[model samples]
Target: MYYTLHQLQIFLKISELQSITRASEELHLTQPAVSIQLKNFQDQFPIPLTEVVGRQLFITDFGKEIARAAEKIINQVEEINYKTMAYQGNLSGRLKISVVSTGKYVMPYFMADFMTENKGVDLIMDVTNKSKVVRSLELNEVDFALVSVLPEKLKVDTVELMPNKLFYVSNYDRKFPKAVSKKYLFEKIPLIYREPGSATRNAMESFIEKNNYSVHKKIELTSNEAVKQAVISGLGCSIMPLIGNKNALKNNELKIIPVRGLPITTTWNLIWLKSKNLSPVAVAFLNYLKDRKEGIIQKKFSWIEDFINV
Candidate 1:
């Protein structure tokens, strides 16, 4: 027979007070009624639960065993209540995020700040390239991904967080033809670029194709930093994020190629599986992003345009 919650509670109250009169008084039941419920439970099992001592009632061995186990249950129940209260009062849980290599530079700041307010929460991240991140999300390997591009057929949804303006840059000494033109962008200078499937590479190609231009040669540099280094060495010019090149620009180690119709702008965006429901931690982090000043993605990144203009 399935025991009811009411039966379990009655059993626990009797175990605590250890007397039918006391338990009955506390539970507002007649003593005989309390005795009947307890006796019914005991009879369902093998326990008799009663032993008559001289002028007193005492519990039998099996009854004491059940009582101790019930006490443990009661302790655990109390602990659960306390934890529930705490959880409702503040955000608490683990947040596992996957980010594109570039997002590793910015996304973590929000994660860090969110964890500070909700100190008990855990933040874990898988940092990978754009392709691997999408793969991981499709396989349900991460809570969400921070990405620059979202593929059309990928089982994912995206929020355009901020515009990631792609610009052409070259070493201070790598002088190009008269005041950057379409042919100069496409044909004259070699491109220090990312891997073939990179969003930056795709966007750059789209711009090139749309403008009716073609690159004579490109020197594929796999990383933004590496591309920056290559451009700094006068190897070639490259398209990269304004944030990525801000410091280099400030130091005059590089200069944005003065190309008209340059900076192929795309969103440095957030992506997630459209079918996956976000867990509490992930939702709270996203809401937290919408709450704070630096937490808000697009508005906080105004310095991007400033970096380009400066």
Candidate 2:
């Protein structure tokens, strides 16, 4: 192919943002320059890489495949650069991480600390639902993934981070007696669930199943923010991770629906594919987590401890 890796990188960025303008802004290039490079790159493919519809840019199926290849090439090149830097005793390169939407609450602190200490490290964090995070790890698109639950089927290395305690919560206006039973919660309250395949939803379902209780799932939402909004609007109650809902809980916008044996506890784990050759930066991060796990969690998650019994 006549296209340069620089052009391929731009193409991948455009595919991600689906806007040449946004890609150009991120790449520090002018829009016309980005468009020109994109057009030139697309010309090399027999089929069009993208289509413009209603002023919106959409990557064609062919474009997606090409973008995937571009992603691989970019990662390999980054790996080589990172390895070379490692030989020279430099810790400078990009680190890609995929995090479950809920992990957004905690990861920024860790990222900030790491980046502050290592000025040359660039971190890319994709905040998505559990399924996409797993897919990214499977594709080796990210160096690591921050998740609450580990998939048993994928051969991976995991380091336990901290407890991810889940709570049954509802709008502050919703009435909950001082104490209630699982039966009362199941029969009285409507359950708002995260989308299917979500780790939070799965954990809630597993709790119900383990306790031999039936739940009334009334609403399904795509994101944690959506679920919180739905609950706050008095649509229904939801089982959610306490880490993400600390502010809402502290402000009394949302309240715990206290029941017997409440706050089902899960764990947060940092995972990576076992077989993949991890870069030096990735190894350094793992080591950082291992060596400073307690201080990091205590410093970042200490606010949560006052509210929940961690």
User: Judged by TM-score, which candidate is best?
Assistant: 2
Give a tens-digit lDDT track for model 2, residues 1-310: 7999999999999999999999999999999999999999989989999999999999999999999999999989987877777678779888899999999987887767777887657799999989999999999899999999897779998888888888888899987666667787776788888888789999888877878877655778989989998888898888888887878888889987665666888788889999979876788888887788889888778888786753
> Clashing pairs in model 1?
none
lDDT score of model 1?
Answer: 0.73
Residues 1-310, model 1: lDDT tens digits: 5655566678878766667788899899998898888877777776566666774667778877877776777657655754675668866666778887677666775666777888657667887677887788888888888887776777776665666777777788766667657687668778767887666777777777788877888798777778888888888877777767768887899987656776666676677888888977777777776677344454556656665553
Give the Cα RMSD of candidate 1.
18.8
TM-score of each: 0.66, 0.80
Q: lDDT (0-100) at residue 211 of candidate 2?
A: 85
lDDT of 1 at 224: 72
